[model samples]
Target: METQIAGSIARMDGSTSQDAIFKDVLAYKEVLAHIMKTCVPEYKDCTIPQIIGYIEPNPQVGQVGLHPDETNPPKIQGMSTESTTTTEERVVYDVRFSAVAPGEDGKIGLIINIEAQSKYHPGYPLVKRAIYYCGRMLSAQYGSVFTQSHYGEIQKVYSIWICTRPPKERENTITSYTLQERHLVGHVTEPVRNYDLMNVTMICLGKPEGKHYGGLLRMLEVLFTGRYAAKEVIQILEDEYEFAHAHTMERTVSEMCNLSQGIFEEGMEKGMEKGIAQGIERGMEKGIAQGIEKGIAQGIERGMEKGIAQGIERGTNRERLQNIRSLMETTGWPAEQVMTAMKIPAADQPKYLKLLSLPQ
Candidate 1:
């Protein structure tokens, strides 16, 4: 869309939360739906109409209804499957939203939760948080009093977190977590149907090792990072008519740049290598130069002030000592006279008399 996404917020701080930008851009179902389909590969078959249901999560808000049970086995990427499952609570999400889409069969629906995290969360690691969110979303499906009362009615939950900074060890940008049915040699367990109830996907927008990325990944790269309006991306959006490509993509990207100026600059510098705009580079350089210039000038000013004070003290002391010696040799003045003329302390008269060879 040629229409510009304009907002009252023009600049963003490094520590600024991306929740506002996220809410504004993803508010469009077309954009949000496109992201859901792109980020979660398993849901590629599900149509946008089948996927998007609620925008943001609120405990105060009631669940619309139970989703269709169409959860396909999750494909874990960049990690191995766990032989066991755990019952633990997920950390509260910064941004929580839901979606509904049918599975491969086109009859069963999946419950999706989209999460956006930008800041560095140390109290809870990203992986742990991802698992927690998945568990919470899965458990939240069957509301005791509100939505689906039946145990069978529980739908598959997709917990997707778009983390700005991922774990150091994980090199890949996308990480998925899934449950697998594994049999142990020693442990006694009964054979039961293993349902992929919850799937956790962490989309890490780190600099990819490869040069090429799919349309979905490209959109996310631009959206999450501050490299405003990559020409190639805009061309792709214009070429491919996805939910986000329908004009909202351009507006959303523009709005993000116009409103949050610096969100794109932090996290990583690889964005610069990806052909960021020259103006942004110039702005950053300008800021750095200005800071350096100001510091140098202040340092010089303080040094000059100290130097002048020291010089004056040294000159005054030298003149007083020379005058004391001259008075003793020229007029053979008394100690009191020399001390008074030089404005020297009374205790220094004896030292001055001894220096001039006068009687102490």
Candidate 2:
């Protein structure tokens, strides 16, 4: 029990599933029975047997509340009244153990509560256990508060706990605490019934000084050794692993292949979208260039018609305008150059040409 409980798969809030808990419980039933039997010696009476019942619906293992004191208190020198109110509050468990025993009142007593622990709340487990035992004994006697008198019956309780770790740095593996009364001034001070406490036996499982914890030590060894020694207990504990290393590798490869395929498909989809966008932009640019060229051609044609009309008006109205076709023949210019130099009105070009020694 000196080693700490180690595991790669640690328990978290959401890690536990119903199936996991059920499977684990079934597999570790033997260990659970052993722990319970060792804790509660009364079960060895050959009457009551250890059982794994369903999880409690309403568990009050860590509950604490303020309650009124049922007894009187001590008086101070200047105090007027000799009474003071106090609180007595604790948690109660819901499970029970059935057994018959002789009570202090020389009557047959039936102990009800078996065992309970507050695993989460720091140091409240032992306190909660005591309160639960008390409550169970009280309930068995009166049946219910409405049916019988308060504190009538005499029942017994046995509370036990199994822990993986120790409480703080305490040395003793098992420690018990109980209520006690001390004499004060002159007359015995009114009994501080609220402080009428009980004992607690804390068994720190982490101590391995002796062989008294054979079962706990074995459990711890299995957890810490690292080497997988296939004992019956280890096999039961390993019921959680569903596959061997080879099968695990195969499953991992399969999942990776699926993920790779999905990534490839997604990348292709994004590429297609980008390509479509670029294609549309290129088509629009090409269409705009073609339109601009066509507009420029039409504008050039309109300008040519306007220039011809103006040239005809100038030749007919202005006397200074000369038919330069005779100057073009005298100069012997090339066809293109002649056309440029002989600036004649197109409407009067035929009459002007008849006047010159030009061919028909």
Which is the leading candidate under TM-score? 1
lDDT of 1 by residue, 1-360 (tens): 222233312246743235655655544455566767766655577676555432222222242323321121011011111212365422444334444454445544455556666643657676676676666656655553137556666666676777665555532356678876666666655423137667788776655554445455566665666655544445655566344334434555555654444644542465665457776788899999999999999999999999999999778756766787778789898757868877888886676566557332
Error of 1 at 343 (Å): 66
Candidate 2 ranges beyond 4 A from true positions: 1-94, 101-129, 136-141, 144-147, 150-152, 168-172, 177-201, 207-212, 215-231, 234-360
Clashing pairs in 2: 176-200, 177-199, 177-200, 178-198
Residues 1-360, candidate 2: write the lDDT tens digits. Answer: 111111211235844332222222222223333333444333333211222221111223333223221011010011011112244433333233333432234533333232322132464555565555554344434543225454433333444443333444542254444456665756565433234322233444444454454453444323322223234334433343211211212222223233334444676799899999988899889899988998899889988898899898666534322335445567876434544555545565555445444543
* Candidate 2 lDDT (Cα, 0 to 1): 0.38
Question: What is the TM-score of each predicted model, taking all chains together?
Answer: 0.50, 0.31
Q: Count the backbone clashes (under 3 Å) in each candidate.
A: 5, 4
Candidate 1 regions off by >4 Å?
1-17, 38-42, 46-98, 104-106, 119-121, 144-149, 167-172, 185-194, 208-212, 230-235, 240-245, 249-251, 265-360
Instruction: Give the best candidate by lDDT.
Output: 1
